[model samples]
Each structure stands twice: as C-alpha cells, then as structure tokens.
Target: PEKRKIISRFGAFHGSTIMGAALSGLPHMHKSFNLPPLPVIFAARPFHYLDGLPGEAEHDYATRLAQELEALILAEGPETIAAMIAEPVMGAGGVLVPPEGYFPKVQAVLRKYDILMLSDEVVCGFGRTGNWFGSQTFGMEPDMLSVAKGLSSGHLPIGGVIISDKVYQCVADEAHKVGVFGHGFTYSGHPVTAAVAAEAIRIYREIDLVSQARRLGDYLHAALADALNDHTLVGEVRGRGFIAGIQIVEDRATRRAFAPELRIGTDVERRCREHGVMIRNMGDVLAICPPYVIAPKEIDYMVDGIRAALDETAAEHLRTGQLA
Candidate 1:
C-alpha cells in the first residue's frame, strides 16, 4: 500500500482555505464548513509547558511525543502514510516551539518508515527564526518546504513549495512524460509580487536579517522573561527569534487556564491594542511577533505595554473574582 495519509498536529494552523482548513488542527479552522474527510491525521502537540508530566524533562517529553507519532504511524499502517507536515515553531498554535531533541527524533522515525517531512515555513521562514529557515533553526531536514508571508515581507502576496532533488526528479520525469507539470496558481508568478519578493530578499541580504533576528531575538526573549515571568497570570513566556507567546493562566502551580467564558486571552489582546501594541491571542496565549528591524528601545516599549496590559488584566479580573 502506497502512503496516502499525511500527519499534522493537534494545535497546528496551516491556512484558511478549504484544503488548508482540512490540513489544520485548530478548532476555529475546522469550524462549521463541514469539511469532508481528508487524508490528514493529527499527532500530539509538542507543547512541553502544558502537556509535560510533573517531573518530565524536555528531552524525555520530546521522546514521548516522538513515540506517540510512531504509534500513530503504526496504527495507521506506515505504508499508507505519505508525509507529516509541521511548522518548526508552530505559529497559530500559540507559537508553540518544539521540545529539545524533538525534530531529530521525529526525523529518525520518519526515515525509518519512509515518511517524508513537509515543513510549513510560512511564519518562520526568512529571518523570523534567527536562521534563513525554521528547518535550519530546529535541525529539521524536511523533504519539502512551504514558504510565504516573509517571502515578500508583507509587501506582496506570494508563497511557494520547495521540494528536494529526489522529489523534484520524480516530478520532472512525470512532467516530461505528461508534457506539463499540470499544476499552477493564478498568481503563481505575478511579476509585481515576484519583483517585491526579490527586492525583499535583497534587503534581507543587505541587512543580514538572519543575524539581526538572532541577536535581537535573544534580547527580546530576555526582556519578556524579565517582565512577564513573575506576572500572576503568566504561565510561560516562549518562542524564538522575533516571534513569541505569553501563556496566561489562573493557577501557575498547576498550569491551569482561565475559564473559557472569561476570554482572558481576548481581554489581553484588547488591552494590548489599547496600549498601542498589537498582539493576537490564542485562547489565553498572547502572541507577539514584532518586526525584525525593531530596536532594543522599541522592544522595551513593547514589553512595557504588555506589562501594563497584564497588570491591568490581573487587577480587574481579581476585583471581579473572574480569576484566582
């Protein structure tokens, strides 16, 4: 049996289109369209903070998740599983970064089962992850890469897939026999978008965006830790490069979340907006992915805004007995 089913994760977010929705595991992404059965299966999310055992270490947690994936593949029948798609630093999935030794172990499993690794680099491509690509950042040697967003640096809409030489050779041979590739998009190679993407690449090269993101990301992460680590509502502050997530919780000891009805994440998002710093919330996890060119002082300002917003959220929720 040739592999057909693809594996995703529980908290993943691929896109908003029908195909993308089917590939995604986010609740909102799967809502109400009554999507038909697709070949996608979900594995455990690699969130150590929320899912880790009381005494489990990061490396062990990674191994456990990898084992779970292996079990999932076995149950599905390895030959019937084609590929597993992943985001190196899961973005819409609350910016969930993988655990230590995660990708290497997962890659080992995939190699053993002849399963291809498809990396979704839409959010972590370019300089966002401190390396040229998220795959590089996390030691993932994916067989394919899907890239967008940073490609044109938000200057234009463009995205593309990159396959390895082995896959490309197969595709080329098929195209030669069929006399065409038989796949395309309306704006597959729009001149304007291509030009913008090209120029964006040039700018990234000129400024050494990768190194900048790496250094600045370290500073940003430190600032966030210093500011929010002790906050009553913050359970964790996590991410890499310029991207980050601040997980808000009711009980830090138990890593408990605020009640859904409280909409704490939405409230934090609203407060951040009011403070003039934009952020999005996934349940109670507030995401902050600032521009790569941001300065230290600007980072301070952003962190301060979040601090003010969090403090206010804590005060109001406490007063109303909405949070403990």
Candidate 2:
C-alpha cells in the first residue's frame, strides 16, 4: 500500500470528530485521546510575528519555511509521504498569516516530491480572507480542499472536501475495485444543509461579499494596529482581512510571553466577553474573526473592546505586582 502523510501545523483546530482530532496538532485535543494515529506529521507554521527573524524579508521567511518542508520530506522518505495539509491563514493557531511566497514555494516542493497538497480552509473559505478561498489568496492549487464554517455562515452543520480530478478518479476506481465506496456519513449530503449552503453562496455573490470583506478587512486591520500596536502588553498585532491576533507578552523588550499559569490571554478574552465582544484565546494570544458583514462602527467597537480589556488586565497585574 502507498503510504499517506498529512503535514499539519501546531495550533490548528479541524474539529473534534475522531479523525478530526487525530489530524489536529493542538495538544489540548490529544491530551487524553492519544491522537495522530501514526500517520500525521507536524510542521512549522509560518508565523512571522512570533518566529520570523528581524531584518528578514517576508519572501525570505517563506523560502526558508519551504526549505524546511523539503528537509522534512527527505527525512521521512518522499516515497512514503502522501500529502501535506495546511490552512492558508492559520486560525486557531493565533490567526497566523503566511509570509509572501509561502504557499507557492511549498507547492513547488510538494510537486517535486510527488506529494499531495491539502488545504484545510475550514476557517479561511467563503471570504474570510477577502477571497472566495484562502488558497486563492495564497496561490495554492490543492489536490484536496476541506471547507466549512463560513460556507453557510454557521447556518448549518456542513463541511466537505473538494478533490482534484485525479484524486477523485483514483478514489472512484478504488471504489469500483472494492465493490462500494465504503465511506460517507449519514449526513454526508443532507438536503436541508445543501439548500442553505446554496442560498448562502447566492447571497454572497449578490452582495459581493468577497470584495466587501477585503475592504472591511483592510479597515479592521488598520484600526487594530493604530489602536493597540504600542500598548504595554501587546507584543504584536498581526492578521489579514477580518481575522487577526494580538499577542501578549510579559516583557515587550525581551518578547517574553506571560507565564502559561497566569493565563493572561484567557483573562483578556473573559474581559472582552464581558464587554459583549467575544474573542478567542490561544495560549497568550487574543484572536478575533468577526463576520464579514460587520460595519465600520462595529470594527471600532471591537478594537475598543480589546483595548479596554487589555488596559483593565494590565492594571490588575500591576496592582498584584505582576508588573512594575
């Protein structure tokens, strides 16, 4: 049997189904489940703010990450590797946006080694990154595309894969050989969910949601950057379109994160919720992904909420002598 390999990054959240959790790279999902099932390989996520060196151009960072992927394939034996998986803009992993040329370089390397490219666009599809798909934003032509979330804008539980012609044909042939496909959930293609998804896509086109997301995403990024970039506890603010993250640090000069035990990210997230704006906390990073239909005023409200939460958290820490 030809071996299959799925190269995922740390901090990804694909879902909690058995196979989904197994494919996940986040330790929290695997703590008690003993996941990964022996076929998945974790790779370095291209997080410029947290990992890219100062003075390195975005293109250089992308090229280096591609090289690292090539090395990993060789070490694992390219013949045994089947596929590489990724989110164009990492979501649960702190809204990490890839550096310039990242996807193209990775695609080139994967093509060279006969490995399949799988784009897990669960959080990035349907205009989240100002495009129909994040793969479009990053120049990735995946052999398999996984999508959910914004497909129906959370109106239904629907997710599925879009496979390239070659893979689809192979699976079809295998099914014929085996007498049946032998794979598919009872709700694989539920009629109600399909109708809702079709309606969602229709509305998105009628309203030009992609372009709107682009315009609004730009405004949102600028608002957050201007308001929070120089804050005392904000180590970095980075993202694209409607998704972004504000990384918190204990010492800005040293780029040291607060101790995990302190749970600064969780505290700030709680504060944002109290203000009626829900944000996600990934370790010491605070992430936000507002709906594409959000208004300019909503963007301001979101930023203000984050700023107020950060200020309140900082004051609390100072009072406790956690910061001097």
Candidate 3:
C-alpha cells in the first residue's frame, strides 16, 4: 500500500513545529534543518504580483495554476496524495494575494482527485482579511483549517485545528478501534487560556471588528494607491485588509529588484522607524500590518512615513550612483 503525501507551495509558512516546518516552503525556515520526514511536496506559489505572466489576465493565470496542480497530482498518482494546504492570503511570504478565481479552481482540482484542502489561516484569520476567515473571503470551503495569531488577540499563546465531519468521523472511527486518540498538547485545555480565548471571541462579535476591518481595508487600499502607485521605486502595493506588502524595485517598468547587497528594504524600514513608524520587510517587500483599532489618521501617518522613507532610499541610491 502506498502512503499519501501533503502538498504545499513555495513562499508559504505553516508553523514552527516539526511537521509544520517540513510543510513550509520558505528556505529560511528550512536552511540546515532535516525535515519534511519524507512526504511533503512543494508546488508553485500563487503569488500573482511576482509570478503572473505579462499580458496574461488574472483568470488566465489562475487557470494555468489549476492545470499545473492537476498535472502534479497525476504525476504523483492521485491516490498517493492526501491533502494540500495554503494561506488564502500568503503572509510571511510577501503577503501575496492570489489572483481572482484561484482558490475555487484549485479546490475543484482537489475534489476531482479526492484530496483534502487545508486552509492555513494563521495570519489571515480574525478580521485581518476583511472576514472572519480567509476561506469565506476568497470563496473556498476547506476540509480542515488551522487558525492562530488573533484567536486570543495575542494576549496568550493559543492555536487550534478545525476538522470537517468527514475527517472527524475517520479519526473517531480509527480511535475507537485503537481505544486511544494518540495525540494532544500538554496545554490542551488550560482553563485560563480557554477563558481568555472565549472572551476574545465574544469581543470580536460584540465590537463587530470584522466589519470595521472591511471598511478600513477599503480606506487603506485607496490611501496606499493614491500615495505610492505612481512612485518610481514602488513596483507594486498589494494586499487585503490589515495585511499588505509594498514591493520596492530598481526599475518599475521591468520589476527589476534592487540588488540584494543594497538592503533597500532594511534601509526603508529603518527610515520609517525614524519617522515614528515601524514596518517589516522580506527582501524588497515591505509589510504593513497595523493594529485593528488603528484610526484613519494613524493610517495616514503610517503611509506618510513610508513615502518619506522611500524618497530617502531613492535619494541614497542616486547618491551612490546605483540609479540614473
């Protein structure tokens, strides 16, 4: 009998555990680590900003990705594949938002192959993606889900997996035969953490944070576009809701990245800090993930700092004769 394997994508981050690390596709997470325990396969990242082909429409790009997934499944023999996991909006991997119709098409392919779809909602969950969950925002119905980060609003460490009835039934049936579940966390049901998480959920519903995130997301997008869309060094500004990424490039027309040696992202982030704001960068992509309670003025302040930093960085590059 052949064992099944899990499929993930490049630039994707799952977690820091043994198996989760194996499932992650980011090299920094895997460098010198002996992992994957031999059953994880990586697929192409669904990042349109960097991966989309010139002259290709979003739908077309999504179709190509679906076809590639199907091809991979067949090559590996569908029976030998178990499930595919993905971040509805990839975080830690450049905040890549998938092209329209991407998840739905990928779901169809998985269904045809009898493969489960696992949604990694660690970053995109709890109002970050303008919804309670990214699955709903992007039109996907996952077989299983892993959620964290905002569950307890970071007051305490907690995460959980939600399984569909089918998966639950399988595990239950097997456990009945074995007379033991065979797995659990030491802090599985710590009362204090559970109580805090419960209150967090209650607050989320009471305050309607999801709706606020949606409204603010629209404002943030518009502000970012208005401020940076025409910037010569900004190749792309893309994201959803509270999560966003700004791609800095040497040449916007060609999307040519500044040489890694320049450390443009680090400098830009440092400059933003000097202006009283802080942003994280992965290579040349600057990330903006503000608190949910942030006000409109704060959003403007954040963007203003970023704009000033970009100008400063550009000036430095010119001074160093790295630009014309």
Candidate with top lDDT is 1
- Per-residue lDDT tens digits for candidate 2, residues 236-266, read 8888777888889989987888888888888
- By summed lDDT, the worst window of 10 consecutive residues in model 1 runs over 28-37
List per-prediction Cα lDDT, in the order shown: 0.92, 0.87, 0.90
Worst 10 residues of 3 by lDDT: 29-38
lDDT of 1 by residue, 1-324 (tens): 477899999989899888789889888777788898889999999999989998999999999999999999999999999999999999988899999999999999999999999999999999898999999989999999999999999988899999999989989999999999999988889999999999999999999999999999999999999999999999999998889999999999998888899898888888988988998888978998888878999999999999999999999999988877
Evaluate model 2: give its lDDT: 0.87
What stretches of model 3 exceed 4 Å from their correct place? 1-3
Candidate 3 C-alpha lDDT tens digits along 1-324:
263799999989998788888888999778887664668998899877778899888899999999999999999999999999999998888889999999999999999988999999989999999999999899999999998779999999999999999999999999999999999989998899989999999999999999989988988898999999999889999998778899998998888888898888999989999999989989889999888889999999999999999999889989989865
Which 10-residue window in model 2 sums to the lowest lDDT?
Answer: 33-42
Could you give me the TM-score of model 3 versus the true structure? 0.98
